[model samples]
Target: MDVDVLIVGAGPTGLALGIDLARRGVDALVVERGETLAPGSRGKGLQPRTLEVYEDLGVLDEILAAGGAYPVGMIWTDGEQVGRHAMFDPAEDGEEGSRFTGPWMVPQWRNQEILLARLRELGGTVAFGREVVRIGQNAEGVTAHFASGAPVRARYAVAADGGRSAVRRALGIPMAGETLDPDRALVADVRIPELERTWWHVFPPSGPDSGFLALCPLAGTDQFQLVARLSAGAEPDLSPEGVRKLVAERTHLAPEAVTELLWASDFRPRAALADRLREGRVFLAGDAAHVHSPAGGQGLNTSVQDAYNLGWKLGAVLGGRAPEALLDTYEEERRPVAEHVLGLSTAILRAEARRGAATRQLGLNYRHSSLSEETRRDPGPLSAGDRVPDLTVDGVRLFDRLKGPDWTLLTLDSGVFLVRPDGYVGWAGDTEDGLGTYRARVGLG
Candidate 1:
């Protein structure tokens, strides 16, 4: 085999997974069609749960240093300040895991860069400009045939190639989708000189059925992410001139105040889930497995979580520590989570629900997952299949102990509990009765 695993994208999902595997000493190669990392301000919100995943992957410090908190939203009308709105639910000081209470605003490009750097530090590399055109797998391994290069073989492969996944199509896997919005929307990153960075500026349309505009300051950068809702049948212009004209016409900012247009794109909002996340020796992750609406900031965070969920499983099986059945649980667990998260993002996009509790994604859990074994007669707030909250246990932070690629047996607060490497409780009970059997089953010896 050319490598142990072949990752078919270098976005946040692929890079994050690469970091996990590299740290576990797994041989994985990430291949990207683009020569460089994707350039965009999209997927800016890194939710709290994903922040914990980063903490384990060894990139949380860099991620925190490179990003900032979300600013409040400011409404404007006829070039006059109208109202103020909170971007997310506020958190109290000293709250449990308050350090990761809300979403962090880091551009998608910067997040990818940080993950890639960490992957490199762990001796993992991404091969760019190698797009897969065909994929064939047998009992031995999977072979990915590229457009401009020789075929590469691996024991397993992953499709992290975005919403329009070539590998998914090559596998003939169908994607079920729901259209959240028929109207087109423009998403871009721009440098505005006169705009204040303290607030995310919003402007309602001046006329009936007209477009609305919002400019949000990107953390740790002078660039602002500009989003505008377009009228039905209106084609979006991604050019710099078009971006400046849109801002000047819709907001109080002058054309020249929009100093530069960094990156831009247009798309109709929608949510989609693949028919299945796994097929034979290959698996799907990120936008390849599920797509989400831009609202609620769920897409990228969910995608990264997908990688976190699958990475350790792959490492365990490839390292000969766990049974192959462990791989089946990846879909069994993450698929439902993706479906629920899609519902959340779509609800916000359709105005059916406000971006509140669900958008934070802190409450998402695997209680219903078959892999989660709750032996307690009545579980507490942190249960089997639940995210292990960060708490100070005897002077050491729970997260600090859970760091790195190893399952931790937390025998405090709760009785004996087996916490998975991704910070979820795998088994919990009032006592250590079945700990030995469970450990042997999951190869935790």
Candidate 2:
């Protein structure tokens, strides 16, 4: 085998998975079709739960430095300030136990750069310009044939490519979903010197035929992300002058006020989920498994968490610490999560729900999974399948103890809990009654 795991794509999901696997000493490679890393501020919001995952991956400090809090929304009408709108609900007081209370604003491009750098720091490799055209799997391993290079064989393969995944299509996996919006939306990063950096400037449409425009100042960078909805069936002009014209027509800024057009793309929002996340030795992750509307900022966070969930399992199996069957739980645990988050994204896009705790994804759990075992007759608020909140016991941070790639045996006032490497509780009981059985089942024995 060329490598233990072949990750197809170098976006957040693939790079993050590479980092996790590299840290565990798993021989893995991340291959990207693009010559360089992706260059856009696409998924800009990082949820609190993702922050915790970053903390464990040893990149939280860099991520925190490269981003800032989301700015308040400022409404403008007729080129005049009208009102102020908060982008997200205030963080609840009870969430203080967790380090991050709300979402942090880091452009997706910058986020990937950080992940790639960290992956390389751990001696991981990413081969660019290697696009997988076909993937074949057998009982021994999987082989991926690229568009322009030699085929790569590995014990397992993961498809972290975008919603239109070639690996998934090659495997004949169907992506079932619906278009969330008929009107196409334009998203770009531009330098607008006249715009103030303090607020996310919003412009309401003047006429019924027009659509709203918003300019959000990207944290840690001088550029602002521009988003504008176009009329249905209209093609978005992604050129510089065209973007300037759209800005002038939609807001008070003139065509030339947009000094630099960094990157731009247009998309019709949609929600989709793959019929299955795993096909033999190949596993689907991130957008390959599910696609969500860019609402409630769930798509990117959910994708990264998908990597976090699968990383440890792959490591355990590859390191000879767990059986190959452990990989089955990856789809079992993450598909339901992708399904639930897809609904949340659609609800937020339609204004049916507000961005709050649900969007944060801190409450996500896996209680129904076969891995969760609760021997206690009366489990307290915390249970086997729930995320363990960061706590300070005896002046030591719980997250500090759970930072590495190992299971943690934590004892709290309620009971004794066995935490999985992914930070979820795998077993809980008044004592260590059923812990041995659970550990043996998961391959900790």
Candidate 3:
């Protein structure tokens, strides 16, 4: 095999998977169709759970240095300061024993750059301008035919290619979901002159045809992410003049306050989940597997988690530590999560759901997963398939111990617990009766 795995696309999802695999000593290659990292602040808000994942991946320091907390939103009406609104239900200090209080505000471009640096630091490879146009897989492995380069053969392939996934289509995998919002949203990044960077400015819909417009100052950068909801049949003008005019007419800001239009695009919000996440030797991840409305900022976080969940399993099977069947758990565990998150983000997009507890994503768990086995008679606050919350045992943080690519065994008064490489409690029991069996089943032995 040319490599253990071939990852298509180099966004946060693909780069994150590459980092996870590289740290596990798994030979993997990440290929991006674009010449460089994605531009703009597409997925700027990083959920707290994703921050925990980044801490484990050894890039948390950089991420923290480059980002800040979400600022309170300032609402304006008729050029008057109406009120300040909270973006999310405030996550209290030490919520669930995590160090991060809430979501961090970092531009998606900056986040991808940090992940790429970490991937390279771990000796991973990323080949740019190699877009996979066709793919063919057999019993042994999969071969990806790129736009120009020779075919790449690997034991397995992953699709992180985004909503319009060429790999998923080539493999005949179907994504089925409804459009959450039919209105076209114009998203752009621009520098505003003398605008307060401490608050996310909001302007509510004024008339029957008008819609909401929000400009959030992207933390750690001078740019602000402008989100304008247009009418159902209205086409978004992405040019400089169009953006400036929209801002001046929609809000109190003068046209000249908008200094630069770095990048701009328009898309209708929709939610979709692949009919199946896996097809033979190829697996779908990130936008390739599911798409969500950006209302709750769940899309990017969920996508990163898809990588985190699959990385260790792939390494185990490929490293000869576990049987190939262990890989099946990827679909079983993530598909349900994807479905739930799709519903969640859509609900928030439609205003049917509040952007508080559910949007935080801390409540998500996989207790029903087949891979999760709770052998203990009665568990305490934690259980099999629950995320292992942070704890300071003997002054060593739980996350510090859980870092790297290995399962951790934590023995407490409750019993002995086996934590999966992805930080979930895989097995819990009063003793080690089924520990050996569990290890053998997952190829950990």
TM-score of each: 0.97, 0.99, 0.98
Cα distance off (Å), candidate 3, residue 99: 1.5
Instruction: Provide the overall lDDT of each model, using Cα atoms, as 2-decimal numbers.
Output: 0.90, 0.93, 0.91
Q: Give, for candidate 2, the lowest lDDT window spanning 10 residues.
A: 90-99
Report the C-alpha lDDT of model 1 over 9-82, residue by residue, as the tens digit. Answer: 99999999999889999999999999999999889999887887888888889999999999999999999999
Q: What 10-residue stretch in candidate 1 is worst by lDDT?
A: 90-99
Displacement of the residue 440 alpha carbon in candidate 1, Å: 2.6
Q: Tell me the lDDT of model 3 at 283.
A: 96
Model 3: weakest 10-residue lDDT segment is 93-102
lDDT of 2 by residue, 1-445 (tens): 9999999999999999999999999999999999999999999999999999999998999999999999999999988999999879867655645877799999999999999999999999999999889889899999999889799999999999989899999999999999988899999999999899999999988898888899999999999999999976789999999899999999988899999999999999999999999999999999999999998999999999999999999999999999999999999999999999999999999999999889999999999998899889899888999998888888988888888999999988789999999999999999988788888999999
